[model samples]
Target: MKKFVIFSVVFLSLILAPILFTILSPVILFSKDNVIREFEKNFNTRLPKSTVSEKIYDDYGGFHNDGMKLYKFVFTAEGKKSFVSYIQKQKSWKNLPLSQAYQALIYGGEVKDFSGNITGFGGFAKEVGLPKISKGFWKAIGDRSVVTARFIDYENLDTKTLINLKSFDFYLAIYDTEKGVLYMLKVNT
Candidate 1:
């Protein structure tokens, strides 16, 4: 009877160990640290302690392999300088056009004026659940800021590729040199 009990205990432990580990491990563990880790892993960069504000929405389960992982980091002057320096060093990143930025980041539902001018910035703030940017946000940063971006799992980045994407993984970093504000976005779907 004791031998049977011992065997049963061993069998249960063997079966439950992995399940517990999967539940306990940091892979699916949602926290600020995990958000930072995921961002660092993909962008090959680090976050500074001078962060002003950050919003992270990570629903990507490790084994489940679904849902979106979104992170937005708003940094102080010192942090912006530090991050911008890092981005400037990377060869993969390119200067993103303002029109493309509007389309990609904003997605859809924009309000335009009679002269074919964009009166409203669009639907990303409401739809994607990211932090909201003011109407003047793009215009304020457009000239002074350095907007750089790079796409993951894509060989060529074009209008068609950006439009036809069913799944995406990419990074965009904008540094307002004058305001000393840095905005970094990492999206995986």
Candidate 2:
């Protein structure tokens, strides 16, 4: 009986391995149109078509097989305040106090790990009235702010928004008193 069980288990493992890998771990393929589609599909809202944006792909882990691609769109709103004001109106997103929000984010969202640091200014930093780049925009990946919990664990709408912040990728989007824009960010795992 022991021999039979062992053989059965081994046989099953060998047979299922290929199928499991192919289904569980898939190579993701996408584009701007795909991004808009995915964003709309996931968020249940239309991704605004008017923004100027592009797709960025970075080869990761020193291998072509390990890579990630994401999208970025700069708004025509002109300043941090305008951008923030626009996004604030999104009911799906909740703005949290940046300093305190980091520690609380891990418990509520689909994101397993989130961390970030203030990096520097965007190209529009000067035009946006940023005197110091770091103080204006924080450059970070795995951003903790502007985060939207993408992974849904329960069907309840409350559960989906239990966290106070909303970010699809939480790519940095900070605007200060002068509407100084500071945020450079991207992350996926």
Candidate 3:
């Protein structure tokens, strides 16, 4: 009886251990380093040593949880070509001028009067744990910019419609062509 019980326990352990690891691997392995690698793999571009990255927020480690990741990469001319090629293949990207990009992203398509008082109020930064980047930073960006997004609850990237969503999964990528810089953000809530 002892022998049978011991064998049964060992067999169960062998089967269950792998299952447990499979479920827990993401929680255990998700880190800044892994995020960088995932970025390179997903974008099919290598980030140079000078690339600046920050984990603006993280609540739960796994993909299913609420968290945010932000990356800024400055690429050489050659690197830019490779990245652009990859981006061009992607569908549903919107090319926006600097001003519109700022309005849509920072202000969540809020309307402002000439005096610059916000007539409409909705923003993604505060909702997704992103810090308020200075308007000067947006102003300094070159004229040509591209924005693309995916959200769980939001059907489309329309600014006004998205304004009222309290919490949802969000992924946004902005590429500044003139500066060869790319900013990628992912928020899951």
Compute each candidate's TM-score over C-alphas: 0.49, 0.33, 0.48
Residue pairs of candidate 3 with colliding backbone atoms: none
Off by over 4 Å in 2: 1-29, 60-67, 77-86, 96-188
RMSD of each: 8.5, 15.0, 8.5
The global Cα lDDT (0 to 1) of model 1 is 0.50
Extract clashing residue pairs from model 1.
none
lDDT value for model 3: 0.53
Q: How many steric clashes does model 2 contain?
A: 7
Kindly report which residue stretches of model 1 are placed more than 4 angstroms away from their true locations once superposed: 1-29, 49-53, 59-64, 95-102, 109-125, 131-156, 169-189
Best-fitting candidate, scored by TM-score: 1
lDDT of 3 at 88: 61
Candidate numbers, best TM-score first, in rank order? 1, 3, 2
lDDT of 3 by residue, 77-173 (tens): 7777776676666553445433443455544665544555654545555654544433212211110111222322231434343444454454455
Model 1, position 177: C-alpha lDDT score: 48
Q: lDDT, candidate 2, residue 187?
A: 31
Q: What are the clashing pairs of model 2?
A: 119-139, 137-182, 138-182, 147-166, 147-167, 148-166, 148-167
* lDDT (C-alpha) at residue 37 in model 2: 59
